[model samples]
Every structure is written in C-alpha cells, then in structure tokens.
Target: MSTDHGDRPVTGVRLQKVLAGAGVASRRVIEQYIVEGRIRVNGAVVTELGTRIDPEHDLVDVDGTAVQLDAGKRYVMLNKPTGVVSSMKDERGRPDLRRFTREWPERLYNVGRLDADTSGLLLLTNDGDLAHVLAHPSFGVTKVYIAKVDGRVSPQTIAALTRGITLEDGPIAADKARLRDSSHGSSLVELTLHSGRNRIVRRMMAAVGHPVTELVRRQFGPLRLGTLPSGHARELGKIELGALLTLARRDSPAEATPGEAREKTRDHGQHDDQENG
Candidate 1:
C-alpha cells in the first residue's frame, strides 16, 4: 500500500484511475460522472474521487454498466495513417484504430488521439493509472507535430504560435513553433505543445492564416514515431516505457482540478479541426 503525505494508506487505485482503463471514458470525464453520482461500487453510489476499491473483488459499474478491467496491461505504439480515427468505433462506419489491434484480444484504448486527418504516432495501453497520469494537465506532456500548411507560414505566424494565441475556449501557447521547410505554395512547420484541446494545432495554424493540409504527430513525451510503418503497432520496449513512467512520476498531481484537467483528457480527436472554427 502506498502512503500519502498525511500518512494515510493509499490502498488499491483511485476510482477514476481504475475506471478510465475500461475504455468507457477518460479519467477527467469519469471524475465528472462520479461527482454527478453516476458511478457505483458494490451497489453504493460513490462520488468520492479518492475512493479506492479492489478491482478483483469490488463490483464497479458506471450507469449500470459493469466495469471490466483488463488483467494484462500492455503498452503499444501505432503509426496511425490518414483517414483512420483514434477511437475504437465510429457511427459513420469510418475506419478506426481497432483495425491495427485486431490480433490482440484485450481491449486497448488509445492513450490520446490524433484526428482522422492527422497521421503519426499514437499510444495504446491498458494501464489506467499511467494513462490518467500521462494525460493529466499537471504533467504537461509535450507532443511534437509536423504540419504542412498552406502558404509559407510567415515569421509572424511562427511568433504568434510560439508566444500564444486566443481560441474560442481560452488562450493557449505552444512550447515551440518554427519553420522546418518552406516552398512557394506550402510550408512544413513543426509545433510542440502540451495542450490537448481539440484541433488545437489546426486551429492555431488556421488562425495565423495557414490552413493545415496535413498534420502528423511525430512524438509524445518520450515516445516517437521513428521509422514505424503506417497502421502498424508494436509493444513498447523497456527503455521507452521506463522513460514515460519516470516523466509521469515527476509530479504527483497535487494540484490537478477538474476544469483544468479536462484540457487534453477528454478532447482527443473528438472534434474535427476542419470544423473547429
């Protein structure tokens, strides 16, 4: 059992942490549902964020749906191709990420998401704790994206992106933004940011008058796309997994809030950038 700073025993995982791995919802959204009295354990409605129950012994359900946690936790990386969604299902019969993991029986959820048009690295895992920690805004995990946008993205655009821009939701800033290459008609610019807002990269670029033609996520924290072929996936090796865990452990989420935590936790690929504005 882990002990908190106040010497309280932290037994089992937190309720939100456990439920997020079930792939029914993200941790932030689960917390909202819990506060709304939508989650129950052992027939009792539980709205406690710190409530911990044994996954092996407790009867956990969300809105009457029993939560089944995967026994074997797996960490994987997929080079998602264009036109493939980051979700497990799509109502319009669009291609989803499930096609790449059909061989694996365990239901693996995407750690985050890349929009249908964005092609690049995506993490898939069954470890709910890690997923919650990594996606939490307090950790500020950086994602690197390469965007091919219309026009030679001007110096003004780079400055605006690097400094910050105001979106309909709020003001957001990129950690870094610079021109990787420039041509007569288009430019390839690289953007690094920790924001998880829907269509953030696309919106930022579009706001600067350079609508993105193609976008690809090359890296997320310590994980990178490398030379992986599109639509293929492989288990993360020891080193990469260790690096990710180390980063997650850097902060214990002492100051995470529901509103701030919603930044990237719930928005992954849910909104199309083409329609963001």
Candidate 2:
C-alpha cells in the first residue's frame, strides 16, 4: 500500500483522509477506530494520523469489512431533487444520494451539502483533497442559485441585497443579483455568491422582505446543473475538472477570478472617492 521514494512514503495521502473519502466514516470516527485496533491498512493496524496509503493500491478493512477504493478518483455532478437529502445515508429514512452511488462499488461522499428543501448541482467525489479545497470557505468557490420569492422584487430591494443585508447571523450579500422574472405575485431572481453560510440566499432574500419560496443551485464554482435530470448524476469531464481545480487553487478568495479582482478594487476605490468627495 506504500508507494514510496527511497523508503519514504511520498505518494498517496493520510490514511484517515483516504478512509473518510472512501465513505467508511468521518475522519474523527476513523481516527477513533484506528486507535481501537479496528482499521488495518494492508494487514497492519494503523493508529498514527501520519500514516499514508495509496488509495489506489492500499487494501483497507474495518471490523473485517473490506474498505473498497477506486483505482482512480471519481467526481460526479448530481442534480439533486428536492426532498432527497444530500448524503450517503439519511437517518430519517428519506431518500438519499446512495441510490446513485450504488452503481459504483467504491465509496464516495458529497463535497458539501444541498439542504433537502433546496436542491440542485451537488458534487459527489471520492477525492478528499479536492473536496476539502472546494468546500473550505477560504477558497471562496462561487455558487449560483435561482430563487422564486413571494413578492415582486424591486430594484431597490435588489440593490439592498447587493449592498449587503444584516440577517440574524451577520451581514451577507450576493456578488450579483437580478430579477429573472416576475409573475402572479412571485418573482424569480438569480443570485451569485461565494459565502458558504447555511441558507444564506434564502435568509438574504427574506431580510430584504422577499422570502424565497423555492431555491435551486444552478452552478457550483465552474460546474453547471445544465439539463441534468433531477435525481440523476453525471461524471465530470476533464475540462470541467481542470477549471474546478483551478478555482480551488486560488491563493485567496479575493483572487479566485479576474472579474472578482476588479470588483474588489472597485470597492476600495469607491471608498477613496467618497472620502475625497
């Protein structure tokens, strides 16, 4: 299981990370299992957090059950449907994403989560490293959503949302927002933001007096929901994968995209101009 260079384990990744990505358990739970003498990597019990294993070549088992790993990492886009939880298992007995993963014997976990009521564009992967970067708020991977709200969203309300609104948690705003459509007292609005705050979009809309009735994630970073049927999944293409990783490698959230740089600079320049005025 050790792919080494000159007797030093140089390839693969931390054992707990690999196990967690394989959907065996959470990293903390896996660490406890390691100490309890239940996890074996290539027939050797692993207790050290530093232990590395080639997920491609490592044979891992827990409590006599084989922990399967893919020969290569898998990345898939799921157009999650409302009412289905975005997890491998749902304790409440609701439908979960495990149905999609049943085709692949290897384990995979959701990159983040899509609240059961707010569906679309969920990433599922067995690559823990990629998952960590995309999910970490420091990377600021942008997510786009379409919301159907309870009232006609005015330009002033939209401006307030763009300028930022204070919710119960804190002030949060969309990087971009516009009314997509309005009909029968319901308004359709699109929002783009990088903050991963739980239910940020719904809360923001509500704060602006336009409570959202339905929400769907349209894009996650570089990946789009695009015609993918609800409750179905598709493997990410190489080009899409490259773009996603590029976003993940940003030095900081502010540097994620060229357009973002201009926006940040404008925010600073606007303040300076106001002071001079």
TM-score of each: 0.66, 0.66
Best by lDDT: 1
Query: Runs in model 2 with CA error above 4 Å?
Result: 1-71, 251-277
**What's the true lDDT of residue 120 in model 1?**
91
Taking every candidate in turn, the Cα RMSD to the unseen true structure, in Å, is 12.2, 15.7
Show the lowest summed lDDT stretch of 10 residues, model 1.
268-277
- Following a full C-alpha superposition, what root-mean-square deviation does model 2 have from the true structure? 15.7
Highest TM-score scorer? 1
Q: What would the per-residue lDDT of candidate 2 be over residues 45-82, giving only the tens digit for each residue? A: 87666677877656677765555456377778988889
The models' CA-based lDDT, in order, is 0.75, 0.73
Tell me which residue pairs clash in candidate 1: none
Q: What's the lDDT of the predicted structure labeled candidate 1?
A: 0.75
lDDT of 1 by residue, 1-277 (tens): 1213456557787778877876658999999998999987877898777777777656566765555555476788999999987777777999997788877876677776677788998888765556666655556678999999999877888998988889888898889998999998999999998877778889888888999999988999999989999889998875676567556644538554333434444343343222111
